[model samples]
Target: MTARTARQRLRDDAGSAVVEFPLVAVLIILIALTLIQCALVVHTRNTLTDAAVQAAHTASLEGNEPEDGATRGAQLVHDRFGEDYAVEVDADEKGEGVVRVRITATFPLIGLIGPSGTLHVDGHAIDEETW
Candidate 1:
C-alpha cells in the first residue's frame, strides 16, 4: 500500500481506541456497581446482627421492661433495615444469664437462584451488667 494510504489506515484504527474506551468504561462501571451492591448487603447483614445482639443483651436480663427491651431490639433491627427484617431474642429460662439473638432478612441479590432466600445472622451478647 502507498505510504499515504497506510497513514490513513492508522488514523482510522486510532479512532477505534476511542470507541473501545467507552465500552470498557461501561463494563467497569457495571462491575463497580455490582461490587457496591454486594458490599451494601454485607454491611446490612452485619448491622442487623449487631443490633440483634445488642437488643438480646438488653432484653435477656430480668428487668421491669423485659418485653419492652425485646421490642426495642426488634425495633432497632427494623429501623436499620426496614420491614423485611426479623429479630428473635431468646432469654434463658434456667437463669443461666445467656441471651441469643437471631436476625434474618431476605437476600434479594442471591435469592434469584439460591434456595436460601433469607439472609440470616446470629449474634450473642451478655447482659450481666444491665440493671
Candidate 2:
C-alpha cells in the first residue's frame, strides 16, 4: 500500500472527534444527574430533621407528651413527602429532652424499578433547665 498523504490523514481524523463527542457528552450528563439526585436526598434528610426539631420543641412547650410531639412531627413530614410515606416518632428517656422521628419514602428509580429510602431525624429539644 502507498503511504498516506498529510491531507488524507487530516481528513480521516476529522470525524473521529465527532464520533467520540456524543459518547463523552452522554456520560457527563449522566454523572451530573446522579450528583443532583444525591443532593436531593441530602436536602430531604435535612428537611425531615428540621420538622422533627420543631415538633419536639412544640411538644415540650405544651407538656412532656411524646405522642403529640410525634404526631406533629409526622404531620410536617407528610406535608412535604405526602401521606403515603411512613413516619414513626418516639421520645427518649425523661431528662434527655430528645425525640426520634423516622421518615420513609418509596419512590421509583427508573422504569418499573424502585427502592425505599428512610430518613431518620433525632431532635433534642431538651429544656436548658432539665437535660
Candidate 3:
C-alpha cells in the first residue's frame, strides 16, 4: 500500500476510539457500581451481626432478660442505620448455657432497599449465671 493510503487507513481508525470510549466507560461505571453495592451490603450485614452479638452478651449477663437483649439490639440498629431498616431482634436461651440473639431484616438489593425478612444473623453468648 502507498504511504498515502496507509495514512488514510490510520485516520479511519481515529473516530473508532470515540465510539469505543463510551462503551468501555459504561462498562467501567457498571463494574464500579456493582462493587459499591457489594460493599454496602457487606457493611450492613456486619453491623447487624455486631449489634446482635452485643445484645446477646448483654442479655447473658446476670439478672438480664431475653427481652432486654432484643430491645437493646433493636435500639443499636436504629441508632446506627436509623428507621430505614426494619430490623427484628429476638433473644432466647439455647438450652446449653448459651444465649442466642437472632436478627432478621431486609436484604439490601439496591441502595439499602430490598425484600423484607430476607437477611438473618445469629449471635451467641454464654450466660453469666451458668458460669
Identify the candidate with maximal lDDT. Answer: 3
In model 3, state the lDDT of residue 115.
46
Q: What is the TM-score of each candidate against the true structure?
A: 0.65, 0.74, 0.87
Which is the better candidate, 1 or 3, if ranked by lDDT?
3
**Tens digits of per-residue lDDT for model 3 on 1-131?**
69999898987766798899999999999999899888988888999999999999999999998888899999999999998768889899978899999999876687655543378999899999998
User: Deviation in angstroms for 86 in model 2?
Assistant: 2.4
Q: What is residue 22's positional error in candidate 3, in angstroms?
A: 0.8
**Which candidate model has the greater TM-score, 1 or 3?**
3
Q: Give the CA lDDT, 0 to 100, for residue 46 in model 1.
A: 79
Looking at model 1, the pairs that clash are none
Q: Which stretches in model 2 have alpha-carbon errors above 4 Å?
A: 1-11, 96-113, 127-131
lDDT of 2 at 35: 82
Model 1, poorest ten-residue lDDT window?
86-95
TM-score of 3: 0.87
Clashes of each: 0, 0, 0
- The TM-score, computed over Cα atoms with residue i paired to residue i, of candidate 2 is 0.74
lDDT-sorted candidate list, best first: 3, 2, 1
